[model samples]
Target: MKIPITAFEKEPLKDHCGIVAAFSTDDYPFFETGLKGLRILQTRGYDGAGFCAITKFGKTKTYKGIGMVNEVFSDGKRKNFASFPAQQWVYQVRYGTQGIVNDANVQPVLLKHRDGDWFCVAHNGQFAKDRNKREEKLSDTVLFAQELARSREASWDERIVTLLQSKRGAWSLVIATKNGLYLARDPLGIRPLTYGHLIDKKSGELIFCVASETGALEQMGVTDFFEMLPGTIARYNDQGLHILHQDKPHQTALCVFENIYIQHGAGRAHLPRKGNRQINRSPTIDDVRRKSGKILAREAPIKKSDADIIIGVPGTGIEGGMSFARAVNIPYFQAITDIWDEPYEQRTFMSAKISDIYQKVLDHFHFDAASLKDRSVVLVDDSIVRGNITKGLVYLLKKFYNVHAVHLRILCPPIDKPCHLGVNTRSAKELIAARLSGNIEKISKALGANSLAFLSVSGLKEAMYTPKNKNGFCTGCMSGEQYPINEFGEPLAHRRKKATQIFLYDNVTNPAPILL
Candidate 1:
């Protein structure tokens, strides 16, 4: 079966990694279940895939490779994973936000502590550095594993909590042990992690699942679902699920980009408010995009004489564009289609390099030029990254079809800064809007759009507000808003840097006696 593209304009954004774990009362082949879950949520990570399971005898077995989930687990390997012989399984799809993409850096970073205990850690979030500059070589996950090994804490849960408290940035983590599974998220809950369970009607066997997206859990036949509490630790095993630790939550600033562009288009962010304290309650991704579309239409109405029809850049842009067209009494058409040569490789917007993404867009996009001839088209897209996709599409339309004029509408506010969380835009210079000094008109002219309009930051905030998350959403990329925690005042990394230290499997980098 072909994996479908769900992004706007085939504009690649380096995706955040995804994690899924299943603990079953029956021997349900959790490894296979985890793999299938990863496949359903493949857009979250395309660089690498890995799975680690703790056998009944307290041994951890891990298989990792650099490629898509299917490519990493071929027919022969799938058979091997099917018989992994474990009740608990943790699978991670990596996009390498903090480290280089290689076999060693692939996740479900299995660690063998000197105390003779084995634990595997998989996470979704970008780890930030300590302002004081501590250990430098490994990514946050691996560095955490190393520090966790060195902890003098007695229990694994305590050690994990300590490590989480010490680090900064977004993290929703699942650490697997022979005894049980432990789950935790950063204080702000910037990234998403949901807890769910599948109950077998006849036997009453319960299978607990934790995943980065709700859609993955639903595909596994899960119905009892909810977001994993932020700043809390939960444990699951044969007995039942238990909350081990519940820390006070920090100010809410969950990544708004997830709702705007990253999440499964069908998924919803269902986080209940704690106690009487008000929080921002987000609508479903579809609802957010649709509402934003309506707001964009009202805020930036197009002249009927200037445009013939509205066209959505397929996938993510379709819902919002349709909403815009409906609000404005204009016809909406899916004039542009994404064409992929490989059935399974459908992510046209996952690459970090603009050149790589531009080439992919050129290879994948098919426009019905004849239909667009002499038409002033209203082109709606999710967000503008490097502005390559919009520019290329406009050029194609005008050059091939003699299009009269093209007006661009974006569903989100202008992205004026690079993302430091899990997104791929690492440098401010790489962002087209920021490069243009946040000048919308210049950006429009550069992209070849006759006129350009973007949703205002306040409008986007209004669209995403809920009774739960009433304060606001993360608009760091759009407005240069400070991030939560220690990442609040730090500068954005304009270029990729290499780590000086390495963790896992003995190396001379810091050859000291392993302690835990």
Candidate 2:
């Protein structure tokens, strides 16, 4: 049977959803605190937002909408939603990497079990098993919650572990039940999950927080946070956090793209000190990007004479661009600025339609033509996926801004393979690098740049390596290397059938015309 494709499946690379949950010992409502954390993690996704809270009255309260975090929890709805007295909550900002973007796909998905127990789940990565036609209409997170709720396991923790261990793919999940909050990460560590604690000043009570990124925890005044180890499941309750189960160590395959593009630069990764897991030091994403930039300069050097000014793509590329300029001894200019007149901060990469993506580019980006006119330019970006945005920018520079030359430098290696783990790049055919057979010249010409260069896989590894992250990274998208674990998160030797093609659905009910 042919399955429908999703808008996300058409995009080159889309952002992953963000999940944040908090458990407070105090009686006060914790949904507000979870919302604040979700705001800080908004960059991870913006397709939709929602939260599920377990009220002090032993009731489940959920509110969701198809928009950003603030939009979902708008001013009019805030008073009523915040009035509830909740001690545990789970929140999600979605990008719908697996399902169509709509109200049905918005998370934290609240479901009731056969035993009449209600649970909510918010997930941050794609579930590999959900690619089949049977699950096409539902988002992976929703399907996961459904499976969990249907499980015959006597306890919530047992149900969570049983369901997660039996599946594959990248996931960092936060589940809320009347009993407490539960958190789990995939065995390969393909997605990021961090947990931290903050002290509630008034009640002198300790609050436990779990988030997809450290930035969210930091927003709640949490200075020290611990990265959840691979194949781990833990629970947060009135007694405090407890590790229920942890799978034996496997080759670590943390998603490398987090540091390169997805994560907020302000977020920090804790590194063990002197090989001691008990002692750790932290490095912000900004530091890693700058270091990567410095290394990229050495790997693909562009002298001052070759380019007059270096311009980093706004938002993610700024840090690396600045460091690249400093490393090359060239002047750096903020030539690209965002046009605030747009209704919302629309990310071009997040748009499903090519026309919509291009329109957003025209509406959102503004070039300082005065400073950039008639000058050689060094354009730095985090990565070049399908090359649409890069090509558009290059076209604007040469056609409108009249730049003399455009030299493009990318901090990430050429993504030749689709990321099956979490990111929405589903087919190699959609990647410019793979289509061009990894030819730098052909890729450069395709992007309308005079020259283009990408950081090597080894260079990326060197830049991202930290003591705590010594296990390794998942470069499957760049190198086409097989993961230590298959798409189902099981050992490769026991792998299931070949990877299945993901169907595209126009909406929850109808399948799109095209079939892969």
**Which 10 consecutive residues of model 1 have the lowest summed lDDT?**
500-509
lDDT of 2: 0.74
Flag regions of model 1 displaced more than 4 Å: 1-12, 134-137, 201-204, 270-272, 275-282, 343-362, 485-516
Candidate 2: which pairs clash? 4-503, 4-504, 5-503, 5-504, 5-505, 6-504, 168-488, 168-489
Per-residue CA lDDT of model 1 for 113-147, tens digit only, reads 76878888898887775667754445667877777
- The local distance difference test score of model 1 is 0.72
Please state the error at residue 454 of candidate 1 in Å: 0.8
All candidates: TM-score: 0.87, 0.87
Indicate the worst ten consecutive residues by lDDT in candidate 2: 503-512
Which candidate gets the maximum lDDT versus the true structure?
A: 2
